[model samples]
Target: MRGWITFAVMSVVTLILLAPIFNIVILSFQGPQTLSGDPVWTVDNFVEIFTQTPVLTYLTNSLLVTLGTTVFGVVIGALAGYPLSRLRNRFARGYSLTLFVVQGLPVIVIVIPLFVVFAAIGLADTLSGVAIIFIAGSMAVTCWMMASYYDSIPYELEEAAWVDGASVFGAFVRIVLRNSYPGILSAAIFSFLVAWNDYLVAVVFLRSESNFTLPIGLQYFFQQNSTDWGPVMAMSVVMLLPPVIIFATLNRYFSIGGIGGAIK
Candidate 1:
């Protein structure tokens, strides 16, 4: 009886969470009604978004920025995190605490100053500028997350590798990183989502339509008097696909038990 009740509760919660997504999917397929007042279903929304809009360009820009952010965040996070995890010195502790504090601060606080700096440096109005902001904004949390995961890994594994004449960096690459797939994926996803979904930073920094990310490009679907919700939802669906696909593909790689036998 208890198990059945729990299942029922979870089912209700799942429906509640999925209701908005279900509506978006449904609306993406909906079209203008027939003369007889029946609803018309068609793929015209997706077709129109492709043909009539610059959505493909926006998608390409988003992909480039997101991919760049993910790679940089993972590499930098791994390097910074390994040290923080292995060392128990005062500087390491202080740096970790600094990261924690920086993570708590809002991104808006640095927008103006960053804009000024980027403008002077000729990075303004560029996709690369947006990516730089995404990388910097997400750095603190990425470091913290990678460091926490590294903490869970056994340091003795590295010691064993060292005994085999492997350098510290080499042991990190072979043992720590080889077993750190889950952590790497987590940081990548975070960085990807930040770069992909950011509107404020993109809008503030990007002046040309050619460099606009998907989040900013979606606004073109709206007009002065009315909004074309069909295309809006379709573009939103397009925006949703990359993250969904990434999560689905990477879901199997996220296992906590892989490191259990590494020591023995």
Candidate 2:
């Protein structure tokens, strides 16, 4: 009875969470309103968005920025984290605390200053500029997450590799990183989401339509008097695909026991 009740509660919660997503997908397939103000079912929304808007260009820009952020975030996070996990010094602890504080800081706070700096440095209105901001915004949290994951890994494994004449960096590459896939993926996912879904930073920094990410490009479906919600939802569905695919493909790699038995 308890188990059945728990399942029922969970099902209700799942439906509540999925209701908005379900609505977006359904609305994306809706066609023009009939004389009676009813929406007819059609694929015209998808076609219109593809044919009329530069959604493909937006998608490409988003992909590039997200890919760059993910790769750099994982690499830099791992590098920074490895030291924080291994070191027991004052500087390392202070740095970790600083990261924690920085992670809590809102992105809206520094965006103006960053815009000024980027504008002066010739990075304004560029996709690369948006990518850099995404990386910077998420890097602190990524480092902390990577460091916490590294703590779970047995340091003795690296010690054994060092005993076999592997240099510190070599041991980290062959042993530590080899077992750190879950952490890497976690950081990559965070960075990808940041770059892919960011509207504020992209809107502030990206001036050219050519450099606009998907989140900013979605505004093209809007007009002065009326909003074309179908294409907007279609673009939203398009925006949803990458993250869904990434999570689905990488779900199997996220295992807590990935490092289990490495010591024994």
Candidate 3:
């Protein structure tokens, strides 16, 4: 009875999450004839995406920013987390807590200040400037994610390496990192998702038509087309592609061994 109840609950949750996705997929397949009867499948929307819309450009913009954020965020997170792991001081605890607090606050509260600062620096409407904000936004979350995952690692490994005449940096590079590759991959994936799924900051900072990321582009696509659900759904499918690919490739990293090896 308990197992049946759990299964029923899971089924309900899954349907709630997937119903809209299924609707979008079905809408994407609707023939492009003003939502008329013919129930046939077509690639017209996807083709129009590449050939007509500036979607490719938007895709490129999203990719560039997400990759840049992941690269810098992972580097900064790993570096910050490693040292914090070894420190037993009260200041270390306070510092980490402060970063957590800052990161946990709603980004809306700071958007106005960021907008003013960006406008003053001539960064208010550029893709590069928006990427900078994305990097900053993902940093604290990435740092905390990595710090906790790294905390699970054994310290004795680093201590042994240090005793063998390995410099602090060298020991970290050779031993600590070799062991933490999985957690690092997980952190990188999480940061990438955060940057990729962002819509609010992107909509706020991006002004030029040419600078739209996928989310902002989708918004425009929805608003521009009148009674064009097919194209709208197609745009959504395109947006889903990258994160799907990333999530699919992450199967190896989520395994017990991948996480366990990353820590110890």
Compared with the true structure, model 1 gives a TM-score of 0.95
Model 3: per-residue Cα lDDT over 3-33, one tens digit each:
9999999999999999998898888877644
TM-score of each: 0.95, 0.94, 0.91
lDDT of 2 by residue, 27-114 (tens): 9999888999998999998998899889999999999999999888888898999889999999999998898888887888989999
lDDT of each: 0.87, 0.87, 0.83
Top candidate, metric TM-score = 1
TM-score of 2: 0.94
For model 3, what is the C-alpha lDDT against the true structure? 0.83
List clash counts for every candidate, in order: 0, 0, 0
The residue-level lDDT of candidate 2 at 151 comes to 92
Would you list the clashing residue pairs of candidate 1? none
